[model samples]
Each structure stands twice: as C-alpha cells, then as structure tokens.
Target: MGYNNLCEIGEERIRRAGEKIKSEIEAENAQLTLDSTPKKVPDIGFRVLRVDDSNYEDRRKNVGSYSQADLDFDVDITKSDRSNLDLLFEALPKFQLPYDVRINTLSGDEFDGHTVYSVDDGRLLACFEADIPESLVRAMAAFSPRPSYALVSEHSLPDSAARTNFVEIFKQSADSKTGSTKPYII
Candidate 1:
C-alpha cells in the first residue's frame, strides 16, 4: 500500500474489520429459526470518525472582537463538505442518542419540505438541511411523540419568523410547558 500515514491505513483497516464482523454476524443470524433455540448475537460494528477544523466560520479572527449579538448577522455557520451522516454522528453524543441504536431518515411525507432523521422513535430528532422551511418548523413544533432534543445547522435556518415559530412550537411540544426543543445545531 502507498499510504503516507497511520491514519489512512487505520481507517481502511477498521473499515475492513467491520465488514468482516458484519458478515460473520449475518452468517450466524441466518441459522436462527423458530424450531431451533435462538442464539443472541452481540452487536458488532464500528463508527469511524475523523477530527478536523471547526465547521462554523468566524467573521472575526479574534473571538474577543465578536459579541454574542454578532452571531445573529450574516456568516456561514456550517462547512459545505459536511454531510447528513457526519452531522448525525457528531450530534448523536451531544443529543445523548446512543451509538448502538439504529437511526432511519424520516420519509419525506413525515416532515414534508424538510429532511428529518430519527433515533429511538422521536427521542432525538436531527434536521441537517440547510435553509429549513417554515412548514418544517411548524411541523416539528407539533411533532408527535415530541422529540426530547433537536439539532439543526447554525445558518440553515435564516428566517427569524421561523425561529420565532420554533420558540412557540417548542413551548407547546414540551410536556413540562417549558416549550423548549433543547436544540443543538452545528
């Protein structure tokens, strides 16, 4: 292999190892039947992640120069290269969603105009779409089995009215009447 560093080789090796384990598990699972005693299969998989620079761009190079209010203005909040899976992996721990749980993307009709990913029913909802639509905000506010936590891209939501709608929506969604989504956006 013409690899330069350990990271490259390690990533590839890890990927292959996971594939090997999954195949083994599938082969084992194929043997289970109602007539035969079911054997429990231990979960075997890996989540490979890499470290990088901050996804958000700072207008002022110096953090001291920017105030809390400055973030409200125009600034690219998320890096373009970031994908749904990347955001989902990053947000999973933050939102306290478990790695072992399987996550599925919500059907387009579920949120209509917006892409939604769900984990453990609606315990954690991640909306990674940029330029979130108003319809989505309203739908999320009224979301059934209201999400315990939500994550959105920082600059994805550009409209203040939509944000305000979310505030009201969160208030209504919360069983405690706090109406908060406890949202975390990267």
Candidate 2:
C-alpha cells in the first residue's frame, strides 16, 4: 500500500481501538452501578491506557519474525474519563494495529517491512528501507549514536546494539536529499 494509505490505516485502527475500549469501560461501569449491586464495592476509575505494537501477536507475526518496528498507545487513567479497568481494556486493541515501512533507492531497488518495538529508557527506535551500500552504512555509523535495535528492510534481521548509529547516519542522508533539517520522527 501507499505511504499515505498506510498512515491512514494506522490512525483509523488506533482511533477505533480507543473508542472500543471506551465503550467497554462505560458498559462495565453501568453494570456495576446498577441498583442490584448498589451495596457492592466502590469502583476505582481508570487512569491511563498504553497500547503498543508488541501487544498484538498477529501484527508481530505478520511483519515476520525479524521485524523491528513497534507502536505505543498510552491513555492516562488518572486523567482519563474511564475507570482504571477501562484503561486496561482500552490498551488491548492497540496490539492489533498495523505498521509498515517501505524504502526505495535511486537504482530502483526497494524494501518493504514492519516491526513492533516497545518503549524503554535508552532504547533507540529506527526503521530503514533502501538499496544501501556498505560505504553508506559505514558513513552512517561514523556520526550517529549507536542504538539498541536497528531494523533494516533489506535484511529482515535486527541489529540489537548498532541500530542507533545507523539511524543517525540515515537521517543525515535523508535530510540532505530532502533539503530539510527536520529528521523523519517516525
């Protein structure tokens, strides 16, 4: 699918999943508040919900075993309108969302792929697709800080400790090509 199409799909999936979790929480609240259960324990409202790609197996499996991309969705329970339990359920559908990346080269070579990396301190996230040469990889490694994981489209394998360095290098290349200083945040 086209890049725009993929982005749309990802947004829609997140929104739908968010709404579903909201509804479920509302329903449970209504049930617990019924007159028959008036004497039951008080309900604690939800505070936050966090959804990420790793939460879903199908998405992970679809991207292949070596995929390196991940998505994270977070809903604050303390600030959320739903109860604590609602936040829990709201995070469920996030695992089903789809994410992919496509790379193209001046030589017409292409690479397409996806991933589901979870969030962690000091962990760098990256995705690359292109007909990259060893010289370019070396150049990228030269200035960029090394990351914990690297997902290169051409090779379905993830580089655990050197991803950050390459991503920084690739960002520079992309910036130079696009004639812009803003790095692709995704």
Candidate 3:
C-alpha cells in the first residue's frame, strides 16, 4: 500500500522483483529502532496473472468434418509454445488445488537432473520434461511424505514402455506403502 507504482512484466522479471523487494524491506526493517519501527513497510506483494494462449491445441472439428481417419490416430493436444509451468498451473484448478498452495521446484542429481514441481509439500508432484525416464518416475514415487498425485505429460514418455514403467513404479510404491493399492492420481 505504501508503493506508488506498479508494473506488468514477464514472469521471471516479476519473480526477481518480488524477491528483491522482500529482501530490501527486511533489511530496512532490521535497521529500524523500536520507536522507528512505526515507519516500517506494510505487508506488500504482487499477484501474477499470466495472459497467454491456451496450453492445449484446438483439435476439435465440426461434426461433418470428423472422418474415420481422425479416429484411427492420436493427436497431441498441447500447444507448442506452452512450457511445463504453464501446463502445471493450468492443471492446478482442474484438480481443485488451492490457489495459495505451495509449489516447490526441485532439481538435482538425485532427480536425474530433471525439474520436478512438488505441490502442497509433495501432495501433488508434476514433471513435464520431455523424454522422462523410468528412474525419474521412480524418484517421484519415492518422494518423502508420498505424493497423492503424480503427474507427467503424456508426451514426456519416450515410448510405451516408459509409460508402462511409470505406472508400475507408482503402483508398486503405493502398494508397498499401504499394503494395498492406494488411490493415487497419475
């Protein structure tokens, strides 16, 4: 509320500015005496609203345009420009995850160098990197606290075998943990 200006910018820049402003306010506050604390900054922040094309490609056709050939093949519904983050956020509301839910970006050698987004402290885990490996799927399944949902883009799997392995790894993980199959969304 103390601020006088607002700017709309790219996601990365906004994130950086938010971090910078938070730190600067904290530093300034730390220097203030008890009496001067009255002049301290108020709770300040920014909300990000991304305006862009839909994450999915439009594959719909008129009733008369639907041909038998269309039924024989698969089509990728995701648009080419959509990033993993875009798809991840788009899925949040569909799953009814809270808007304020915490999302952690995880990437390390342990995850096989793939970026994984841990939602609500691993209650929901999502990875959209291409050519996702079996090891990464297993790692996600083995996440601490055990995610209730494990999500990955269909196109991320290199082949049918990888997709099968992904399901199996999570299924086995659930089975071992609960001594039965648990309802884990994937």
Candidate 4:
C-alpha cells in the first residue's frame, strides 16, 4: 500500500539507498583494484511516535467549571486511542529519562496487569498499569542497578493506602543500597 505507514516507506527507502551506494562503490573499486578500501554501510533506524490528542482531558477547558462531576468525568485521564507506546513516550520526559535511551518490555513475572518498562536494563523502570500490585512495587523498588528513578501513573494507582505502602517499599529499598532511586507519580 502506498504511504500506508511511515515505517514501510522509510525502510524501503533505506534499502534502496544502500543498494545504490554499494553498486557505485563496486564500480569505483574495479578502477582502484588493490588500492580500494572497504566502505562501511551506516546503520539506519527510526523512533516512531504518533501525534494524537492530549492523553489528559483538556484541563483548561474544564477550568472554572471544575467540580465533582468534572473530576468524575475526567477520571480516565488518558485518551482512548493513546496506545501504551504513546503513554510510555509521553512519560519518558516527564520522568526526566532520555527518549533515545534503550527500553524493553519487562518480563519474568506478571505484575497484576501492569506493563513495566525497563530502561537501559534498569537504569530506570516504570509501571503504567492501573491498581499496581504491592509485589510489583516491591520488585521495582528492589530492581538491581536500581533505577535513577521510577514512575507510576497518578491515575493508575489511585489508592492512598497502596501509595503509602509503595513509599515504604522505596524507603526499604533505598536503605538496602546507597544513592537515590527516585519514585514519582505522573
């Protein structure tokens, strides 16, 4: 499909460009023979993010009219169409984590429906799942090479008691090790 998606066209263009360069180099190498030096093909890659409506309801629009009804209406801060990738990228800068840093989906154990992201293999970790489990919080708090920080969506884990317990786990994890493992709610 023509222009169906950016990734398709982008990769195809890179492949074609590489082929063209290699062919030209081969022709030039024929002239140089023993003097010819190898040409390295540079790596090609991309980072994809979609431009979408704000994840949170437009607070400016709701201002002055803010009320219990508005609060209840705006409970689901994130937009319906915003995917997990979208939320993760949006939260990256919020946590002061670099966007270009490597990140992978955390595996090994399920965390009560939460999706965990381990950045640079635990330089930082984030969980955006709602109603985050205590076990999950503890795991994050104790994760090796302890992240410079961690983040949970304020909307995701709204329970006060659970939040308190999460802070306590951070305290223990911090005590067991030196340095700060910042934990924040976005």
> Which candidate leads in TM-score?
4
| Candidate 2, residue 163: lDDT | 40
lDDT of 3 by residue, 1-186 (tens): 344445433545667777877788888877888777534554445457556777886677788987777844433567778778788888888668966777889999879889999889988889888787788888888787787788888777866678778878877887554442222322
Per-model TM-score, in order, reads 0.66, 0.20, 0.67, 0.69
Q: Rate the local accuracy (lDDT) of all candidates.
A: 0.69, 0.35, 0.74, 0.73
Off by over 4 Å in 3: 1-45, 51-53, 61-75, 175-186
TM match of model 1 to true structure: 0.66
Top lDDT hit: 3
Query: 62-121, model 2: which lDDT tens digit per residue?
Result: 444443333322111123233323322333234322222221221212211222222132
Per-residue lDDT of candidate 1, residues 4-95 (tens digit): 99988987898788778777877877887868764555555555567766555555547777776775654455666877877677667776
> How many clashes show up per model?
2, 21, 0, 0
lDDT of 4 at 143: 78
Output the TM-score of candidate 2.
Answer: 0.20
Scanning candidate 4 in windows of ten residues, the lowest lDDT window is 41-50
In model 3, what lDDT does residue 139 have? Answer: 87
Residue pairs with colliding backbones in model 4 are none
Query: Higher-TM-score candidate among 2 and 3?
Result: 3
Model 3 worst lDDT run, 10 consecutive residues: 177-186
